[model samples]
Structure formats: structure tokens, C-alpha cells
Target: MITNQAIEELVAKECERYELERSGFIADRQAAIRELVAQTGILPESCSLIEFAEWKERLLNDWYTRRRFAGFFHRKSEKRCMFRMVKRLLQNAVFRLRKKQTELTLDDELKMEEGRTVAFKLSSAFFEGFYKKTCCNGTLFVSPGHLETVCIDELSLLFPLKYPLLYARLTAKDNEFWEEIWRLIRRFVRFLVVDMGGKEDTEMIQEVSMETVLSVQEQMERGKLEQITSARHLLNSLQMTGRNKFREWLRTESRKREEILLSEEDWGKVEQAKEDRREVDTCGANRRFDYLLDIDEKDEYEVCCALVDVLSYGSGKVYGELVEGREKLARAMLLLYVENKPYEEVVRILYNTSDTSKLVNLRKSVSRGKEYLKKRMADLIKLYKRKGEVPFATE
Candidate 1:
């Protein structure tokens, strides 16, 4: 079993290893920057802003080229060294053959030559930016404080890589521990990103340092990590809620703008409209002669089931014509209304979707079914009346 102490020790060791690697990287980067400044003969204070920008772009291009080439030789384990060596040899051979066959232009030859020497170049935009930001009066001078800032930025990128090592180590002993830790790290990173939008790497890394990891470990030991995670989720939810409320407020304002307040004459028109509706209602009341007998719920279900059976089995040409190849609709209605299944269940049984958003579509299907039944109810009543076999009790 991986105890909390064991986990903490492992984290501390990994963090120490990361710090060493980060320090070395920063030292190397600073040295490279100094070399490039000396070799290029472009003093930062002497150059115009445009020239400085172009120089930085060139440095970035060189860094990207070197990084890409180094990535080719990066191995996860020492066991793969022989394999990579063989692969590299084969690639070199293929490249030589291709070079011999093709007529290389001056540009192509220069590019190839640059590729060969890219490993020796020490131009990294990351470090260049760091140098500019941390230097005193734009001078190419390295200090411990500048190196620390750069190290923090590099650690932000390095922390994610270290988690997989923790994951692998904990898999045999305590998988849940690794998972919980991973969840906290992921949530913390997301919260940082959202809370500090478009901030520089160093600024973001200030929140994601080794101290933060140790704090998380302490929180996990005390069983408070879950509460912390829940708080973060609540914060995110509140942000979304605030945004939604703002949208709702904007919509309300828009609607208020579109609305026209009524004058006294408009009020009189509203009263006149009420009177017209009452007159229509009175006429409708007087014209209705046919009465529908009330049935209990059980009887209603039986009658509906019988009607569905008639429609489904194509009992008559009229029934078949009314159904019109809407068997799926009929089934959906039966499951949704008659069976009293929830929309999600009906969707799973019908459209195979449990997604809440898709439940609206199921509701729409049930609504269409209701409308179909209402529209065809008159036809069914007429058919039953003509045959003198109406299912319901009549007046």
C-alpha cells in the first residue's frame, strides 16, 4: 500500500529532480542567449523595435528547428536507444541517396547545412523573452532572480509531464490515489487558465509551483481535496450562472424596448376584444350537440390500446390510411404516454439517446403523435358511428 508519507516522498523526489533539470535548462538557455547576442552584434538597446522583433522571430525559428530535431532522438527508455540508432542510420542513408539523385539548389544546400548545425545553436524565444523581461535596462545580464522566473515558467510545462510518472508508480499500489491527484491537478490548471486569462507562463506558474503540489498533498492527507474541488466546480458554475443571467437581462431589455405601452384608447380596444371572445365562446357552447362519455383511466387505457392495435395491425383500409406508415410514432406515443416512461427512457428505447438535450426531440415526437391522434380522432369516430359500434358509452 502506498502511504501518504510514501507518496509525499515520491512527489518531493520528483520535484527535486524537476528543479535540477529546470535549473540546468535555464543556465544553458541564458548562456545561449549571451552567445547569440555577442555573435549577432545586435545590442538590444541599440536596435529599433522592428529590428528587435525580427531578431526575436529568427531566434524563435531557430529554437523550433532545434527542438523538432531533438524530439526525433528523444527516448522514453534506454532500451530503445539501439532501435533509434538503427532508425537514424537508415534515415541518413535514405537522405544521402535522395541528395545524390536530385540536383540541389543553393537554398536547399544552405538549408541542409543549417539543419546540420542547428544542434549547436542556442536561440530560444522562451529564454529571449525571459531575458528581455528580466534584464536591467535591456542589458544582456543574467541574475539569480531572472533564472528563478524562467525556471518557474519551465516547471509549469514540466509539471504535467511528471504526473505520468506518478501515475505509473501508483498504478500497482494505489490507483485511486493517482486518479484523485490527477483530477485535482487538472482542475487546478483549468481554474488557473480561466481565472487568469491570457497571462504569461511565469504568472500562471506562480500558482502551479511545487509548493502548490505539496499543499495539495497536505489537503489530500486531511481529506479536504474533494471539498476544494467541489468549491472550484461551484465557482465555475456560478460564473456560468452569472453569464446566463446577464444574457437573460439583455434579452429582457430587448423585449422591453420592443414593447409598446397601451393608451386609454388601447385599453378600450382590449375591453372590446374581451367582449368579442365571450360572444364567440357563447356561439361555440350553443352549437355543440355530440357528447363524449367519460371513461375511467383503466378503460381509457384499454380503448387507446385497442385503437393502437387496430392502427398497427392494419385492421381496415381506413385504419391503415390513418396510420400512414407511422408505426414508430405510434410506438413512441405508447411508450411515452401510455406506459408512463420518462422521456429519457423512451429515447433510449426508441432513438437510443439518453442525452438531456435530445429529450426535447422526443417531446416533439410525442406532441406530433398527439396532434395526429386528434386530427384522426374525428375519422375514427365517424367510422365507428357508421358501423354502429362506437366503443364508448353514448348519451
Candidate 2:
């Protein structure tokens, strides 16, 4: 459990330490930032106008980390609740910075939620380590039941590593993403040195003044962010010409006028469409399967069981039959084809293997599974067709 007294004491100790080292570190950081600005000339390009420059400076100084931290932890009691507030502080700071950087006039929550969902889903889809169910509100977690080091700045680093798919999509737009990256760096430095009192420890503070902060900043300047961005761009280009692109290209080139890349918002729509179809299928399939098998469906899992029951109805109880495997294959077929997932992604997700040979074998299995499903499910298909219905409902 956490209490207001503990929080206030923490804040007081942190603020006192910050106040002691504030002047020197602030001077060092602002000088380092200005030196970088002078050297790279990136700042003036973004803030060409005098007003833009002044506004950017005001944003830097007035964005007090102490106030933000206190505003979140002033009265929080539960440790979990206090940590959640910490996460919120990180989120809100990033959201505010993004709104300022892009000048996007949309609702903050709307923008933040979309961005978070995109990051979460892309990480889950591509990275074997990232689990969507386990992530806390799209922020990175050290492990299950622990979420200590989840700053938005860390996410800025992690997203490019794991959420490259979304990064590729965003990079295609003519937006100020690089400028946002710079702002993220600045915000991270401010949060670390001033807000969080990152150097309050015993030895490191005495040994190296602000080298930790400056090293990270220097690393960022040495093309790290650009490297990450360019790598994603190259990968996306390769994917465009690779096997993944062929099916989509064939589908779209015949009818569509432009190349279609899935953006974050686009992926959100795709997931929403899946959910909507799942609901309709749950209702219709429950009714149809009940009529066919004389059993009631209680949930979506039961609906899947009903489908698997159809697959097993004619299977022999003989040896070496692989009855359960075939039933699982049938379910995978429905999820792959009926749910409209890309074959590569479905294979990647189900098998958790990126081995090219295994993927090739899985792709072949999917084709065979589809044919088997068509043959075995002819009656159900005919029933739906006669009723003028599609498997997954449109709209």
C-alpha cells in the first residue's frame, strides 16, 4: 500500500535534491541542447519563425516535471494506483508533446489511443517477445506483474525496434516525425534530470556530472533515430517487392488506383472489422450449429467447438489418424480464411516460427486445409449460400 505521506516525502526528497543540483544541470543541459542546435541547425528549420522558436522554448521551461508528478500522486493510496498514475504522467507528457509538435487539433485521447493501439498491435504481430494481452495500455513492461521502467521516451526507442510495421506506415506520411523524435529526446532529458532526480544516487552523481544524459543525447544526434527510421523504410521497400506484397498487390492493382499501405488507423479499422464479424458469426453460427447438432452454444469458444465437431463427425477412430490435429487444423483454417488474416502472419503467429522452410510447409498446409474445409463443410456452405449469407458478415 502507498499513502499520501509517503508520496509527499518522496516528492519532497526528490524536489530537494533537484533544487540542489538544478541550476548546474539545467545550465549544462540547455547549453548542450543549444550547442547541438547550433551544430546540426535542425532546430531553426523546425522553428524558423521567431514565434515558433519562442513557443518551443516556453514549452521546455514551463513544462515542470514536479507539478506533473505531484498532480498525479497527490492523493493516490494503492501502490498499483500510484504506479498507474506514473504511467499516466508518461503518457500525458508524450501526448502533449505530440499535440504541440504536430499541431494536431484532434482530441488528445483520440490521438493517443490510436497511436497506442497501433504500437501495441504492431509489436504483438511482429515481435515474439511482445504479448498484447500482457502489455499495460500499450506501454512496454519489464515482465508480467511488474511495470517499473515504462517511460514514453523508452517507448520511442522500443517502438522502432518492435513496432517497425507501424513506424513504416507513419514514415510514408509527410509529417514532422523526426521533429517529434527531437522533442521526445528533450522531454526525456527533462524528465530524467529534473522531474525524476535520476542522479540522486551516491556514486554515479559524484563520478560523472551529466554524462549519462549527454551520452544519450549525443547518441540520438549520431543518426540513431534516423538509422531506425531508415531501416524500417528499407524493410518496407523489401516487403513491397517480396512475397507478402504479391497477394495484396494482385488484389488491389486490378481495382484500386493507388498503392494501399496499412497505417495505424487502418490496422485499427481492420481489427474492428474482425470483431464486428466475430459477433455476427457468433450469433448466426450458434443458431445454425444448434440446429445441426442439437446442442446449445454458450460462448465463442463453444462456437469454435461446434465447428470442430463438424470436422470430427466422419473421422475414423483408427490408429495413426491424427484426429485432434485435423480438428485444430480445421479451426485454424476457419480463423485464417474466414477471419481474413494474411497467410504469412497466421503461420507466423500459430507456429511461433519464422523459419522459412517451416513457413513454406505451413503455407502448403493452409491451402490443403482450405480444400479440406470446402469438401467437409459443403453442407454448411450450401446452407449459408441458400440463405443468401456470407461466412463472415460484411459490414
Candidate 3:
């Protein structure tokens, strides 16, 4: 019953509306990106072309990853690039309105009970409100029970959970800044709790919370160093290259771990270890699997950075060996796998050869790469098991 003219008109109208909506989203995203760049000091514009491209990839991956958990209600608004940003703005407005009406009132008298331990109930909604009101633009992944005790140690874990992408972006010197952010959040929480009750009543709770954050940050840093050390030991064991190489690697890595303190020079060795891990799968199954598994754990932002590192640094390494001097192999991998670009477009960009011959070869390489990655992961899992390291298990 629909005429061709009517369909064309409808399509035109839809296109016009989409363009208007997209314009608004672009403006908001630019503003947010500006703030993020300033805060993190990772200026893509100031960086070299290669660094800028990697930064762009990281942002694109982050945006894609956040979309997964953003639910329909958040995505319905075509006026923002990030659903989390929209949600934060909405929460901020609502909280401001509520603040004007009254102070933070408790749901029950039990919350006001004068016991030595203050019984504070942490809710997801309240956490969102707090984060929004404080203007902490970083995305969070905390359950309602995450702040059950508000212990400083427990609160420090929030930094890692709240900003996994940011955590991955940090260098050694930048890592210390987490303590400052942690302190800010802790103070914000204390202000809210104290506002709800008398300062005298909340003083002890605030002190305890501060202590918790400090202790937790220390523990987290220590654990990170241990993990890096364990990875190095495993890589050394792999160098044996024989029947019992895997077993020997595990034993040696654990035994020498405490003795081997990493100096600045040793960091390069660690990066080489990661490259070896990537190289384990010759045809390439394990690399893809490793990436997929990490994406699930870290969301897209961290995964994108990981991809950039591999592509940028893996030259003359395992990935280079497989591609056999195909200069565009890394770009091809990013376009095909990370960006999920179409075959025709990828070929055009990668080789300017959109023929079936190249397409077939690219497809085969991907398939073989995945197989190789899986074999590598299997070995990785075994090594983790031996060292009591939590392996990135395949789904």
C-alpha cells in the first residue's frame, strides 16, 4: 500500500532528524573529551600522529565498551555521546532539587541508632547521586554492598573498580595520584554522612574510612608489583624451550620472584615478556582470544590500549613473524577486529586492493590467528594454575 514517493519522504525526514541529534551529541562529547584530556594530561592534539591515532583508538574502544552496560533508558537520548554522562547530568539535576527541599534523611530510625558502629546503607542510586554531585566523571562499577563498612581500605578498591580504563592509562609516576582522588571521594562521602548526622557522631567513622583507603591502596600497589614479577618469572621459564619447559618456568618464576627486584632497565624485559605471550600462537588464535577475554574483564577502553600496544610494539615479534612484512597487518587487525569494519573498507584502507584474492587471504589469516591465540591461552592458563595466578579463562 506504501508508495515509493512516501517512502522517500519518510527516509529524508529521518535522515534530517538524525543529523540534528548527532550534532548535539558531538558538541557534548567534545566538551567531555576536553575535560578528560585536561584532567588526565593525555593531549591527543599535542601528541605525534602515531600517538594521536592510538589515543583515538582508545577513546573509540571506550565509547563502544560503555555502550554495552548503558541499558535502553540511557541510550534513548540522542543528545549525548556517552550514556553515563547523560545519567550523571540527570542525577546531578535531581539531587540539586532534592537538596533544596531538605537535608539527607534516613529511611529508618535504625540508621540513626547511637551505636559505636554507624550503620550506613549504601545504595546504587545514592552512589550515583554522590558521584554526580561530586563531579567525578569517571565511570564506576560498584554494587550496592560495595561500601558496607566505608573502611578506607575498602574505599581504595573503588579507585580501581571505578576507573579501570584510567588505571590502565596511568604510568608509574601517575599511579600515585590515585591516592589523591581516593582522598577526595572519601572526604565527599564523609561530608554527606556528617551532614545527615552530627559531626561529633560521624567523626570516628570518617577516621576509620580514611585508614581503610590508605591500607587498601598500599595492598593494591603491592599486588600489582607481585603480578608483574610473576609474569617475568613465567617468561624466563618459557625460555627453556623443551619438554618440561612449562613446569620449569612455573617453578623458577615462583622461586626467583622475591629475589628479582625490577629496576628501570627491567621494565623493557617485562614488555618483551608480554610480546612473547602474544607470540605463543604462531598462526594467531590465542591473540584474538586473549583480547576478547581482556575486553570482557576491562571493557573496551583498556582493550583498545592493549591493541595499540601490540600493534605498535609487536613489530619484529610474533605478530610480525606471522604477517611476513605486510606493513598494514596491524592496521588491518585493528580495522577488522577492533573496529569491526566491513571487508571492502578494510581492504581499501589496508592495501588499496579490494580484490577477492586479498580478502580471502586476510580472512584466512584471522582464522589461523585465532587458533594460534587459543593454544597460547591454554598454556597461559596452565602457568597461572601452577603459580596460583588468576588466569583469564575462556568463556
lDDT per model vs. reference: 0.40, 0.38, 0.39
RMSD of each: 25.1, 24.4, 28.8
Better of 1 and 3 by lDDT: 1
TM-score: the better of candidates 1 and 3? 1
Candidate 3 TM-score to native: 0.18
Tell me the tens digit of each residue's lDDT in model 1 across 248-356.
4345446534532233454455445334433323334421112212222234333443344334333344445556667677677666544557666887988676764
Q: Against the hidden true structure, what lDDT does model 2 obtain?
A: 0.38
Q: Per-prediction TM-score, please?
A: 0.26, 0.23, 0.18
Segments of candidate 2 deviating more than 4 angstroms:
1-78, 102-364, 369-395
Tens-place lDDT per residue, model 2, 1-395, is: 22334334533443343331232223343443443333322234343468654643343333333223223233232234334434444455445554444433222211323443332322212321222222333443321112323344454454322334444434443134333332333333343334335454422221122222233334445644455444334333332223222333234334333312233455455445334433434444422222323323333333333344343333332101323457557545545534557655766777787654454455446555644543334445445446655333122
What ranges in model 1 sit over 4 Å off? 1-319, 387-395
Lowest lDDT 10-residue stretch of candidate 1 = 286-295
Q: Global CA lDDT of candidate 1, please?
A: 0.40
Candidate 2 lDDT trough over 10 residues, lowest sum: 202-211
